[model samples]
Target: MAIVTPLKTAAEQTLVQQFAEAKGELPGGPAVRKLREDAFAGFEAKGLPHRRLESWRYTDLRSLLREARPLADGAKETEAVTARLASLSLTGLRLVLIDGVFAPELSALDAIPEGVTVHSLADALVQPRDDLGRILSGPSVGADDAGLALNTALMRDGVFVEIAEGTELSQPIVIIALASAESERAVFSRSVVLAGKGAKGTVVEVSEAAGSAAQQVNGAIVFETGDESEIQHVRLLTRQQAASVEVQSLLVTVGASAKFDSFALVCNAGTVRQQHFVRFAGEHSEIGLRGVNLINKAQHSDVTLIVDHAVPHGTSRELYKTIAGGEATGVFQGKVVVRPHAQKTDGGMKSNALLLNEGATMFNKPELEIFADDVVCGHGATVAQIDGDQLFYLMARGLPRVQAEALVLQAFAGEAAEFIADEAVRELVMGEVEGWLHAREAAAEVSTV
Candidate 1:
């Protein structure tokens, strides 16, 4: 019998050539370069994640990504880009990245918040700290993932933040990763956050587009929480171009007696995947993960996560809400793992989706892998259309059909958004939801007209 090798996809071939050409120019010392080489080797072996892989069955990158765009160059903060960045500003310590390159002029680095230290990843890599490799390597949960491997191999620049022990930040830290429509290219960035023991703070990451050009952004953020610390993270993925592709991952390791809470809002994205890989590294920790996905008009959105209970007395709660209208598609894949010695673990997960029309689609896959008998774990999922009774009740009360539907959808998605610990952040998320609903209503009116 003769053995034959599979043909490489165009994207894979382009990525290989890019790596070989840019290997020497990428930041980092020998150790970091070796790490990148190893990561690219892994990707070269696996190729792009396809439907054959159980984890990537729903959103197949191999099929979706026809060809690879050239690597993003150093983008100039043009007048238009500056105006766009200004509009997305929030009241906090803001760090901005344009085309995956750190923009110091736009970032609020001159203030130097009291107990917090920030550095550009590119600078850190060139200097090469001992722990930098470990941080960039990421946790075991997603270390072997193909997308993550590619990110590690090509990651150019991102923000690195450290909070001093026992320090409480006065305001949230906002990091914005914005794409430049002037360049049709790919951007890969990796960011890290280290919360010292007993410290408390909130971090918000906003991934938005500068204009209506198609681009690719593959980014990852790693978070490590110390014992007795509390950290709140909010990720808002919005206003993506219709033909753009975005893959973002959150990798976290929670410490003993610490509290970690995260929320993600996905709206108006083209092809997007928001994944989370979390591990309870210490005992007696608690985590809450929640998200809402609003997609319509041929958009594709996916939220996949894995929560690992590697220690005893860990607790996790997850809930996700999705609204798919027009010809959009939404997917939620969640799994919770309880190690054999992870006794006294408590976990609960639920996914609820509302389809606004016959053309919309939703996929929910919830699973649990428990090796411990002394644990409490359960999962549930529900998918349905708007409740006719509720809609009728609103309409009979003098509200128009569009307004009634919007109200109903708002209430349905509010349960997940209300979990944000910060009042202002929660409201900001709701505002995005309202904006999406308004757009939906306008589109409906146009269709009827």
Candidate 2:
């Protein structure tokens, strides 16, 4: 007798079918094509991770994605997208991707900066350089996740950037991905950045889903810092609540004596999940990971970070803060692992959240796994609301209840934002924080009225 297994969910079935049919027309050579097959198989077997999985207990993917949206058309652009580009303050090279497609018309790179090389992912795939062929064809760029796999299978056009050895960029490089005027469409985008040995630079990724129809966007970033180099990365999410779902991921490898600082701010999107994977590949590497989540409404936001210490004499620091209002839900899960041979490792992780209403929910989980005898690793999490005494003090000083609460919120969130070394970036984040606070206050007034 032959038995048949039940079919996967509609969304899962659609992803598999789309990849199978569009595999050839996607990109890359045989190696990448095969990798796509393996990735699809892995996702097929697992379907979508749910509460059953330890890694995804708080946020369930299978239930959130009921049906798969069609792939986004990368070749088109809308006037709204062009209009929105005028608001960004550009002090560096700008690369804009409209609706998952690279838009050179909107980008500002009049002259190629010295000591830097740039190529679109599509261009690199067509005529792979002897040095970049193997990397471009590598399987999934070592990011292990279903969303990343989906991005790998559908990654056709993105930016591939490299900084020459010992070159310090005069200005930061900004890559903006805008999903403008797209509804029920799936956006797949990926990028790779290489900071050459002893190089110094800043790379900022801004994801904009604002002022557009509801869309599904999945993005992945792979960054490598060479020995004795320094790299700064900032991920700012400014999507609107209309977006059905979003998955943003970061994969970083720090080399010996290199320094890496990564900061993220999440203040938008209805359902957004952030996954960050950091690996210390050599000794004497230093890293700092920090983020803040400002969420409201009935939306959901999740931030999961993993930092692995695989070598001796490495150090990592992580701090995350979340503020939830209305009936929104926020989640923070962070893990640090020190291998057996990774002695002299120093790692610390801390996450704190604040709930503004009774219906608001915040899930916090911090874990430390250590196999080395000579290591200092610890993790802690705290979830709380506004301190009554603090509120009373502000209220006694003639501040309204709303203003007092907002002040307390700013103090709580500013702790994480202060970790950003760049003054400009810090100010930018603070501005966004104020904007969100005002929006929350306005919403509260409307509800009461």
Say which candidate scores most in lDDT.
1
Q: What TM-score should be assigned to candidate 1? A: 0.98
TM-scores for every candidate against the unseen true structure: 0.98, 0.94
Q: For model 1, how does the per-residue alpha-carbon lDDT over 1-449 read when each residue is reduced to its tens digit?
A: 99776789999999999999988899899999999999999999999988898888899999989999999867567766788777874778899888888898999898668999999888888874888787787668887789989999999999989999998987889998888766578999989999999999899999988855788889999999999999999999998888888999899999999999999999989999888999999999999999999999999999999999999999999999999988999999999999999999999999999999999999999999999999999999999999999999999999989999999999999999998887888889999999999988998899899
lDDT over C-alpha atoms for residue 109 of model 1: 91
- Cα-lDDT of candidate 2: 0.81
- Model 2, position 208, has a per-residue lDDT of 82
Candidate 1's error at 131, in angstroms? 1.6
Q: Which digits, one per residue and each the tens of the lDDT, describe model 2 over residues 327-394?
A: 88999888888889999999989999999889999998888889999998888899998999999999
**In terms of TM-score, how similar is model 2 to the real structure?**
0.94
Please give the distance, in angstroms, between residue 317's alpha carbon in candidate 2 and its true position after superposition.
Answer: 0.8
Best by TM-score: 1
